[model samples]
Target: MTSPLLVGFLASFALIAAIGAQNAFVLRQGIRREHVLVVVSVCAVSDLLLITAGIAGIGAVITAHPQMVTVAKIGGAGFLFIYGALAARRAMKPSTLAPAQNGSARLISVVLTCLTMTFLNPHVYLDTVVLLGTLANQHADSRWLFGIGAVTASVVWFFSLGFGARCLSGLFAAPMTWRILDGLIAVTMIGLGISLVVS
Candidate 1:
């Protein structure tokens, strides 16, 4: 029998494997070891919501609304482009010393940054809610199973990203590392944006 848990786990991991702004931000936080839990929680919760929405038949509505999708795409594309540019610029600038302790403020900032990165990028909705939803429906035995799998995936992904990034921090510490990451982000954002506009 096909285990919903297994399906969900694999699907979620597969989807998140594609590196994006969220992943980038998560990695940075992991390296810094700052507010990691808060960031992961926000990302996990956001994914859960999106995945639920997808499995609840909202995916069809989104797919049917090409106009709405187009608008979202344009907005997402623009946001990504600007965000990428900013990351690149920051990479070019000299790194500043780490800020003094402020746990409350840091936590809030992590949550908000994650929320903005996830919510503002309409592509996230499309990918998690619409695409994943449609895919789940195809494989799910029932709606409940779909939801179960989807949520499970979110939990697994967030924890993995939050902790796993720390393992690679050493490699990412090099000055050239930030430049490479920033450049990749910029290219990805621009490419995605242009693709959305053209399509």
Candidate 2:
């Protein structure tokens, strides 16, 4: 039998795995190996809070207020489009291939950027609060367990993405690697932005 915990873990992992603004920023920070602990902590905690809210019926509240979703969509779409353009610009630049270790942005700047990316993105709310929350409600008996599982997934993913990314240092040593990554990020962000606006 498929346990609610397992269902939550798998479902959350699947949705979270999608390449979005948060993931991109996380990946970048992971690659740069700067303030990773802080970054990962923020993401995991943010997800936990959002997931808890979802399980607690915030999803329904959100559904009842379509205006909130609309605001999120507009804000998210705008942020995503701008982020994508920045990625696209980076992809065009040849200097991106160089080691960014010393060039890492200030901790405060990075954290604020991370916060903006996390809070401003509406999909996070929809996915964690609405979709996952609704799915957990289906299990009624073990909804909290399901939330725990989802929370676990977030913890594992962020930590792994942040720490394990160092393993890719060799592969990403080349400039082409950065180009490819930024290119994909750019395309993904733009596509998501357009989707939000149109949908």
Model 1, span 1-199: residue lDDT tens: 6776677667777777687778877876776677888888888888888888888888888788867777777777787777767766756754621222212335766787788778866677778888778777877566557667777777777778888878876776676775676677667767766776777
Per-candidate TM vs. native?
A: 0.82, 0.90
Clashes of 1: 0
Stretches off by above 4 angstroms in model 1 are 96-106, 138-141
- In candidate 2, what are the lDDT values of residues 1-199, reduced to their tens digit? 7998999999999988887889888988888778899999999999999999999999999999989988988988898898899889888896754456237668898888788788778888889899999999999989999999999999999899988887887788888888898899899889989999889
lDDT of each: 0.73, 0.87
By summed lDDT, which 10 consecutive residues of candidate 2 come out lowest?
Answer: 96-105
C-alpha lDDT (0 to 100) for residue 54 of candidate 2: 97
Candidate 1 clashes between residue pairs 3 or more apart in a chain or in different chains: none
